[model samples]
Target: FLFSLQRKSIVAVSFIAAFLCLIIVRLTNEVTFPLILNCFGQTSVKWIPFSNGQRQPLRAHYGYINVKTQEPLQLDCDLCAIVSNSGQMAGQKVGAEIDKSSCIWRMNNAPTKGYEEDVGKRTTVRVVSHTSVPLLLKNPEYFFKETNTTVYVIWGPFRNMRKDGNGIVYNMLKKTVDSYPAAKIYVTTEKRMSYCDAVFKKETGKDR
Candidate 1:
């Protein structure tokens, strides 16, 4: 009789544990989906003009150049191609095919000058990594001043792009724009960056 009772107790405990697990899973699903849905594929935030609290000095020798607000690209094209920095495309001979697309997006500091036969010479947008900012700054005059029409979207951590005056990369980019006066560089907003982190955490169930 005691053995039978112990068996019933074990079965009861197992049933309760499973029931709790199911409830926890249901609750997590309910909360996780709403938060992640808002961040799905969000790469940048709106470019509203920064207030005094959010703005900082460009620290130019001539004068300060304030970061201007701008809107995201409103492409009306039906076909778009995202070109990644992959070595497989080194000799793919797809330059003509890539150029045929209505719009193109490139990642990081991938150049099209030498690899035009494989990656095409046209670039609608280049999504730059934060680490490449310093490199671009080295030749800011040539890259930003000379090519004033190329649009660049840079993404990085909060410390690199923050407006609290401590953002090293942000200040450097501001200086570049101040000198060039016509360079087009867009830094991802903090909100979008946080949302991206949240999405990553939710998907991985760990902090990014």
Candidate 2:
């Protein structure tokens, strides 16, 4: 009877080992961390498509996500997605504040046409009421001069944002003070400088 009991235990252990081996084989896959965006009271996600410059259709997949929401948003077949250069901290501010302001502004205001639109770029949604951003220089009086002479504010003699952003903003002031016809254009980082006819950091209307 004792010998028979030992045999039975051996068989049970072998069966359990085999079951674990099967599970290991089935679960052998690379684990990939997913990117998530928390919005409103739920989580929303969109698939990003890969582009090849040629007029070819892109491919995408619904990234893995977990959230509890009553409604699921329908996704389009296109892969064109916009994201900010900022990191996680900035993203929180964007969703909390920027999104609200942008909603109201778009409803009552019209988007400006004829300006060169940025590719693969996004704007932070503004939320706080009447929290106006001083779009132009500290002193708009100098940046926009009303005179017989045409003074163009050049963009960049500096290239990298860390390396060139301050130089670009500061040199605009220098050009106005020096009374120069051609100012350095700092907008483009193709690492080249050119002349401009009329330039403004941002345009604002009296109505706004």
Candidate 3:
């Protein structure tokens, strides 16, 4: 009789434990889903045990956000977000940034902190077949040619703290050498700031 009673106790305890687990998971789901549903593609989260019966929050590392570029198409681009997790998740949204959390919504337009970088290694400039660009931009003497050179460009001030804020500088210059193999290219600043100037001169054949 005692053995049968012990068995029933064990089964009862098991059922209660499972029910408690379900409750915890449900609460976590409500907190993580409705708050982060539209942001990224998240299928599920798996929780694990820690020391002292403590449970760690589920971690979804990748595929959190997709940043859409501006009007003109671009290859080198990013987005930004705000995340907060200090037992203080209320008050205001903007106060909490995304990088702070294990999740991210989009890439930002600022550089990271503490890195030696250059200007030309910052943002990107792409060239395609149908881009409203020009070929030989002749301004009096110099014939600036935009040949079969399509690329992703990044130019930076190199300091993470830009515009008086913290940022980082990462130059993704692989597109140029990889895409335009054997295409002699010069990414020069003297290269007009606006495409309007380049195209106008090309159409008019005018000097500076």
Candidate 4:
């Protein structure tokens, strides 16, 4: 009887040790995975769990917020291709290849209509500066009306992006959305813009 009792105790101890190990591993991943992703310039990770026990990828709260909806932007892409409008891409002819990516990101007011051979035709996200807002508005029919499905993430100082009727750029964007209701426009929050500057400074050791 003593031998049986010893064997039972051993089993219980092993089970307890395994459970503790699992908890440790879970905690480690929750903490370390986000740091790893941040190093790669990803604003958010994909392992966040919901109340229903479902996992969903989430962008940082400081990231883009929808202009019309006033809600956080929720977007996840397995592979993203950032298309740059550089002279080096003149002869690349990689439009088809870039289009294969799950998401394509562009900067400023780069247009891919004529240069579709080098830059992909589809734009998943466009990061525009306040100064470039005029360039985009130059052809609202092309940028806002036609590419209504593309998400626009504008970054600017609080002075230019504020919504209190004093922000010039914000007022322009508000008018754009009013004209084109289908446009998906988001502006980076002040916190997000500052976070971006911090990341840039950390990476380049120079203020942006």
Return the TM-score for each candidate structure.
0.61, 0.19, 0.20, 0.70
Please list all clashing residue pairs in model 1, or write none if there are none.
none
Instruction: Please write out the lDDT profile of model 4 over residues 1-208, one tens digit for every residue.
Output: 9999999999999999986776455434454445445566664544553443645455545478888888777787889999986878877999999999988999999878888888879999999999999999999999889446899999998999998999999999999999998888999988988998899999999987
Q: Rank the candidates by TM-score, best first.
A: 4, 1, 3, 2
Model 3: per-residue Cα lDDT over 45-144, one tens digit each: 4334343254544443221111111112212124423322232433333323433333232111222122112111122222211111122221201212
Runs off by more than 4 Å, candidate 3: 1-7, 10-43, 48-55, 59-109, 114-208
lDDT of each: 0.68, 0.30, 0.32, 0.83
Model 2 misplacement above 4 A? 29-92, 95-208
lDDT, candidate 3, at 45: 44
lDDT of 2 by residue, 1-208 (tens): 9999999999999999986665444234222223212322223332232232323221221221111111222223332223333333232433333322311211101121221132111222111111111243344453334431211222233331123345544444444445532322122222323221122223432221
Please give the distance, in angstroms, between residue 175's alpha carbon in candidate 3 and its true position after superposition. Answer: 9.2
1 or 3, which is superior by TM-score?
A: 1
TM for candidate 4 is 0.70
Q: Give lDDT tens digits, candidate 1, residues 1-208.
A: 9999999999999999986775455334322333333454322222223432442222111111125544444333457889979899998989989999866888877778889999998887677888988877776665676555666778789888887789988888777777877766777777777887888899999986
